[model samples]
Target chain A: MALLGILLFLMIIGAVIAVETRNLLSSIVCLGAIGFLLSIVFLFLGAPDLAITQLVVEILCLVILIRATIHRRVETVAGNREFVGLAVTVVMLAIVLMLAISMMAGFPSLGTSVLDRMAQAPSHFYLLQGKAQTGVTNIVTAILLDFRAYDTLGEATVLFCAVMGALAVLRRSARRRPEEGDAGDEGEGGAE
Target chain B: MSGGTHQGGMSLIVRTVTRWLKAFILLFGIYVVLYGHVSPGGGFAGGVVIACAYILLTLAEGRERTARLLSERLAAVLAVAGLLFFLGVGLAGMVGGRAFLDNFLVGDSGAEPALASGGIIELCEIAIGIIVSMSLFLAFAVLSRFRVSLGDGDETATGEGGAS
Candidate 1:
């Protein structure tokens, strides 16, 4: 619990640094740090798989963000608009914190459940029958690839759509630039 | 912009490290995907790891080199092939008088966790891994190429015209 609190505090600091930094690269680096910390927290919370996923996803996001920010100017948003945004964010944060604290008061402690026996039966059934039904030792994998295979298929389809959409948008932009006749000169051949 | 022309990526040390680690990363990804039935990682995680290896290569060795290794057209084809393989596996199961994605193989469960244990699940994992890795690599490749094309605006026009 203390470790969790420490992680949460560091996360908040990292988030603030990410938001407030004028350097886009530093902001992305800070964001990656937060993601790494959050993945560690996930591991502590007994979700190693989630931790692994979070780490890899965070790395990929960082790579993409860095790529996008390259060749772009890093401009800081300042003045009255920034102050107003900060004020609104603080207010929202306070409200969220209050609500979360209140909700936590009603929840049971670790290793204890607010849910009744009947409500917990499905998980118990899975723990007992997962291996026999799926011939897989890892219950999580069995559940994901066997019991909930359809959901995974749906997720794959969504991924496919997203990739296709990105390609289509890129292709359209490439096509449009030619007709505009405002083509800039070719620059470097390698990474910038 | 001209700086990129001179030094494509980082100095010698970083590039050397990346080159050495790239193979291990790719191998680990395949291991994760193949052992999904008995391990912590599944197709998605493994695929992302695999994609990261290519991304690392691009970041280190430069886009031109990576493009030569796995071109956009090949990536697109691989993505489609992965999806088709997945669909084919499901259809195969259905054709065997079972439900879609059913485990059709009638072998006894192995004593130890082996590749042949899970009938259709292992195959599905492989398919998913291929789809995810290829799609992600394709997305990154397309985005990077788009950025380059935008940078070299006139070149895109001529290239597109020639291709068409």
Candidate 2:
């Protein structure tokens, strides 16, 4: 419990630092720290698959963010110029915190879950007959790839959109001919 | 390789280490993908790991070299192919059975916890893995090559040239 609390506290601090830090690199690193800490929390919660996914995704995010930011000039630290936006953020955070705290009352006891409390819980079905139905030992994978395949498909589609968005936004002369490139280079040289 | 605006990669130590480690990382990623049904990691995690292997290589060898290794065109093609294949699998299910993205081809092959088991699950995982890795690599390629221009107001930011 103590360890979990410490981890949660650290994650909150990391979040604050990530948003407040002037240096883009420091903010990125702090965001990465929060992700890693969250992954650890997932591990503690007995979700090893989620932990592994979180860890790898964090690494990938850090790499890409660092790569994109490394060459860019960030002379100015941009802040939220609009006070209304800041106020909205605070209000949203407070609402979310309040909702979370209030929802805790509805949560089951630490050692018990829907599987134990309810007879018709989906988890019970997964735990009992998942292997028999999907023929896979890892029930998580069985659920993801077998039972909830459409969800996986949706996730893939989302990833596809993200990649296409990046490509669309960042594409610059994807099919420039060699001659055109040389001509552009020569033009630049002439201007210089 | 010829026309990009990137310097040579990091130092010799980083390059050499990357050279040795990338292969192992790639293999580990495959292992994770292949054994995903039997293990903690599934296609999504494994594919990211695979992309990371390539990303590491890219980090060490610079964008041009990495582009040569994977290439922007090839990554895009692979991503499309992966999605098509996944859809193909779904259509295959429809031809012989009911429901979209159904596990029609699974079962009747192998038991639990083995490589042979989880029929369509394995296939779907491979497809997802391919899609994820290639798309991620494509995103990285695009992002790395992106140039943010601050000046030259008349040049128009969209068409401002950066050699692809």
Candidate 3:
């Protein structure tokens, strides 16, 4: 609880820094710090997986923001237009915080005992006897790999596609290089 | 214009500190990916670390080398590998009869939460991390490159480009 309080304090500080900073890069860095601290709070709350996911996503967001900032002056504010964006962002953040706090208040504590119960469930039994299973000691590992492997596979595929898609959108098509492809084709291709 | 071929006349301290920072970023990335299960880290965290490290490297050492090292083909390969690893694990479960990815027939449930049991998740996490890191790096490289290209003839553009 003390940690949460500290984290929340830090979160507010981060928010203020991110908002008040004229340097876009500094703001983005502060935003990333906010996310990192929030994920630590989540870890303290017994949600390591969530923390990991949040950390990963936050990094991705930071990279994207940094990329966007590279095209313009980091400290150049777009007059009052940015204020509108800041307003929208604050409003959205507030709504989300409200929803989250309400949800947290309503939830009951199940604790680590759920893991033991889940370990003994019928699905758990089915997971243990598998032949191709990797002899990992973590049941979460087995469930993730041997039992829920399909989901993991799907998730990996999705990430791969997302990465590819981002690369495609952000970079020149590798195949379009004249040196790599037919050099003669470019002159004709330009007419099309 | 401090564009006199000397790297903005940055002091030795700044240069050395930046280099150390890049190394630290890369090391942290490796740690996050490798020790994901035991700690509050995982493939995703590691991958992002790798991406940051790459970006820092690019910032310190020019883009061409970084681009060459992180080629499009390598990114594609990492993505495919992640997908294949995930599918291969699930297919093993399907072969044993309790639907796709079922581990009971494969003797997984009887397993303890030792390194071996956690290895699979770790593997998947690593795969995911690679895909993510490469993609983000690619995005950063492209965006910066585009802006540099656009700033070619305009003073204001160059000012804005260098300002960030």
Candidate 4:
């Protein structure tokens, strides 16, 4: 309960700071902090893997956002458009929070014991028969790699595609011709 | 010195520290990749660490040097290797007369919990980790190089044309 209270306090403070800050970079960093803190709370709630995945994805998103924003003009004051954006963001956040609260109120916890029992049942029989061969201690890994390996394969393929797509977009404006590069080099040499 | 205005100048001590930190990051990344199953460290974590290290190295040593160190060929090869390793692990199970990625058919699943206990699932984790980290590092390296080049061009246009 205390942990939840702390998280709530930090989140509120973070939200306020993110909205109130005039410096664009500071606001972005604050948003990243809020994300990191939220993920830490997730970890404390027995969701370490989700916490790690969220933390990584959030940090990457933050970096990409900051990098893009760095190249753009930062308005010191919140304009009308900015106001609208903030309002929309707040509305979305509120709706999501309400949904989460309501859903969690009715949600039954899927304890590890059930998963353990599953691992020890058909899976156990397979093991005893020398037919179950997955060696991951973490049941999540076992499920991910063995029982639902097809889904994991699909997700991995998607991630690989995304990486390739990003690389393609980025490589478009890369150094293309040696001549152009050489021209730039010669120009630099002449200037020096 | 293909020095760009945007690339901030650092003192000797700062450069030294950055270089040392870069080495530590590289070593840490390798550790995470290799011991992913046994520890909290895994492929995604290791890959991000390596990406951070490459970014740091780029900041310290400049774009051209960073590019040379992380050649496109090396990144591509690593990415391919990671993918192939993961696929190979899965394929091994199919060869054992079971469905695709059926590790139990290969005598790797449902073992004891000792160091030599667990079976093929452990290998799959390690493979997944490798693929994830390698792809991430490759993506970051390629993307950042593109950014640095554009940044270099902007610097040159703004009258900072001298090479360092």
Candidate 1 residue lDDT tens string, A108-140: 776464345356667777777777777778777
In candidate 4, what are the lDDT values of residues A27-115, reduced to their tens digit?
A: 88889989999888888878665576667767766765564445444535434677788899999999999999999986555444443
Model 2 residue B48 lDDT?
Answer: 98
Residue-level lDDT tens digits of model 4 in B4-61: 3445424456568987788887888776545544445455656666666765665565
Predicted candidate 2 versus true structure: per-residue lDDT over A1-192, tens digit per residue: 789999999999999999888777799999999999999999998899999999999999998777656534456636668989889999999999999999998899765768778999888998888888888888899999889988998899899889988798656443343345444453222211
Q: Residue by residue across B1-164, what tens digits does model 1's lDDT show?
A: 22343236545676799989999999999998899878778888899999999888877767667777876678778878888888787778788577987667622454577887777788888988988888898787666656533233332322121000
Give candidate 3's whole-model lDDT. Answer: 0.61
Chain A TM-score values, per prediction: 0.80, 0.80, 0.57, 0.61
| Regions of candidate 1 where Cα sits further than 4 Å from its true position | A82-99, A111-120, A172-192, B1-10, B106-110, B147-164
Quantify all predictions' global Cα lDDT against the true fold: 0.75, 0.79, 0.61, 0.60
- DockQ preference between candidates 1 and 3, better one: 1
True contacts kept of 2: 0.51
Show model 3 residue runs off by greater than 4 Å. A16-26, A48-60, A70-105, A109-147, A172-192, B1-31, B96-98, B103-123, B147-164
List RMSD in Å for every model shown.
5.6, 5.0, 7.4, 6.6
DockQ, in order, for the candidates? 0.34, 0.41, 0.26, 0.32
DockQ of 2: 0.41
lDDT of 3 at A173: 35
Q: Which candidate, 3 or 4, would have the higher TM-score against the true structure?
A: 4
lDDT of model number 1? 0.75
lDDT of 2 at A51: 98
On residues A108-144, what C-alpha lDDT tens digit does candidate 3 reach at each position? 5534444464567766574454333455433444455
* Stretches > 4 Å off in candidate 2: A71-92, A173-192, B1-7, B108-112, B147-164
The TM-score leader among the candidates is: 2
